[model samples]
Target: MMAMENLKQFLVLLSGAAVFGIVSIVFVLTWVLHFREGLAWDGGAAEFNWHPVLIVSGFIFLQGTAIIIYRLPWTWKCSKLVMKLIHAGLNLLAFVFAIVAMVAVFDFHNGANIPNMYSLHSWLGLTVVVLYGLQLVLGIGMYLIPVTPASWRAAFMPVHVYSGLLLFTSVIAVALMGITEKLIFALQNPKYKDSPPEAAFVNVLGLFLAVFGALILWIATRTSWKRPSDQILHTLHTNGGSEDNTKVSPAMSQLSGGMDAEEAGEVRRRNNKFDDNTN
Candidate 1:
């Protein structure tokens, strides 16, 4: 059983690595080979080029990594608090990249006298970015802020998780749409439009994005993949040099062993909060 579990974990890790590799290849093929015009603020199409490159690297790829960070073997040795910080930080970076990418598009538009938000891709991209920013803020407030009430945290947890997955999916969808729109709009040549190498490469890139998202969601949604309570405790001890102050929540307690009356009450409260959220 132990060996089987280890093998499962290894396969999971391999899947994640493969996703990352595909993402990197797609990035290079899109930004480096197809469009060699590096980023520029005032260079019209060159400035606009940053949008896809940054969006894919930061929004899609890095964001996927942030979502699956918990499954990474390196995180097992780190304190949960540290992992939380890393998670938040990575997301913030992704958000920054997305914001800059959007900015690049706007800047290019103004410089080139082109209209903005004129396509389905533009509208969906804007909406995803806005919701993603809100998700990040609420996540930080709920999880990292020590003063947040346990009731609030419990109530918000489900929404947070749901919205995160939703937004991640939305980002990938928007990216695929954006690339398609770009291909249709920019590829004016008959040869390029009719099954050209660039078009084929980008279409494959879109498939990569979809596959990466699938692998990430698979790892994230697996119940057995959650951090073991014992591992969490061990990490806390290693980081703090003592375990006297760390308080495992009811959820963790339930995972570890039998729940005492107090823990049972806590679980009831959590359930009530969840019920309220459902309503």
Candidate 2:
């Protein structure tokens, strides 16, 4: 009953996140295609339109989904390695989109003779992107590389998780600042002060972004929703092991309290085999 209730809550939050994410993308697209000059690569305002569209769709939405991918119950049965690859793939795609968006902005600025990376929004956005790239590289190196020491992976896991979430939140905040900055610069006739339709529409987009981020964060942080370790699953299946005996190794818990059952089982099997050989 409790599990069912949790599942229901998770589904509701996931659905809400999906709705907000889609709406945010639509809002950004409408803002660019309808209110602005639409997309182009001509080093003009049209090219700049791609920046917001890609950022909202690829950077913000994709990254947020990737962050919570491991928490999905349906994928819990998959090997950790497989899930890691998927997670990395999503982040890589998001990074590519972010790079393109940055290029669009830079090209637009250069063409217009406008200064670049001057505002708080630009500075923070650039910083977050760089940090996100660094985070991705480090995560791949530490987690994906089999040669990497288990102890090192365990020690770095908390930092990796925290940094990912921090980057996710920071990007959304940067995006909100970015849209507002654009509105301030773009709106002239009615002005942003008069609360034009575009201004109101974009404001709602910002609200959607905020709500989406909140839902993703909530889903990611829930301990009960975390994947169960192989040890726990094995104990439940066998109906033999004591609660204390089924507890995961300190290293495994540190690595990921919710690490995939298959991966954990494989590691334990290997360890048991080594013990037998040593004996």
Candidate 3:
């Protein structure tokens, strides 16, 4: 069972890594393309236009969600503080995205030239993508980490819930913009009267991926095990999260305080066992 669980962790980590890798490759390719010949809107008012704007915007919004969620500092007796710290640090990559989104929206006129602001926004957007891609990779790492603090279901679920909402909003905004940009761009170009197949494909695929990711995160939030005595001793109680960290028994609290997080787990397990036998 332990081996199987470990395997699951490994595979999840690998999946996250793979996603970031792909994103990196795509970012590099896009940068090259933009540098050499720019995207379809390089010359028009839409140049530095809506599609790129939308993509960057979505990324930024996702970043803000990630920050608020990741900054959660809670290490209960069941989980380690260092791990939480690492997770939080990794999560800050999302902030880069939020910054980009704001830039993308700055002084962006509906149908006129925006070369100066666009240049700045584009540069900032690219930076956000690169940094936030690392956040994705780190998420994969966090998933694989065996010794995560015990506040999993409680500590992070709410964050995930709110973040999911944010992601939905960002994606919707970006998706609409992407579709509209394509329609208008296509309309303007008599050479190609029809909307290209890829616009629909990209927009649809992005939405699908975002939805699927949210579902997976929600599913992951369905586990929590707490010591009974800890609950009895504490007057304040919520689901089970950072706030409950200090409410643990003296031994668990002391050991957690004094020992390294990984070693502290052994002490915590023993204390839990003793508490069970006493009851």
Best by TM-score: 2
Clashes of each: 0, 0, 6
**Which residue pairs does candidate 1 place in steric collision?**
none
Q: Where does candidate 3 clash, by residue pair? A: 41-47, 60-97, 60-98, 63-94, 79-149, 79-150
- The worst-scoring run of ten residues by lDDT in candidate 3 lies at 249-258
* Candidates by lDDT, descending order: 2, 1, 3
Q: Write the residue-wise lDDT of candidate 3 on 43-140 in tens digits.
A: 34333343344343334333323332321212222243454454444345444444443443443443344334344334544444454455445444
Per-model C-alpha RMSD: 8.0, 5.7, 12.0
Better of 1 and 3 by TM-score: 1
TM-score of 3: 0.42
Q: How do all models score by TM-score?
A: 0.79, 0.86, 0.42
Alpha-carbon lDDT, every model = 0.70, 0.83, 0.39
Which candidate, 2 or 3, has the higher TM-score? 2
Candidate 3 lDDT score relative to the true structure: 0.39
Cα miss at 124, model 3 (Å)?
21
Q: Rank the candidates by TM-score, best first.
A: 2, 1, 3
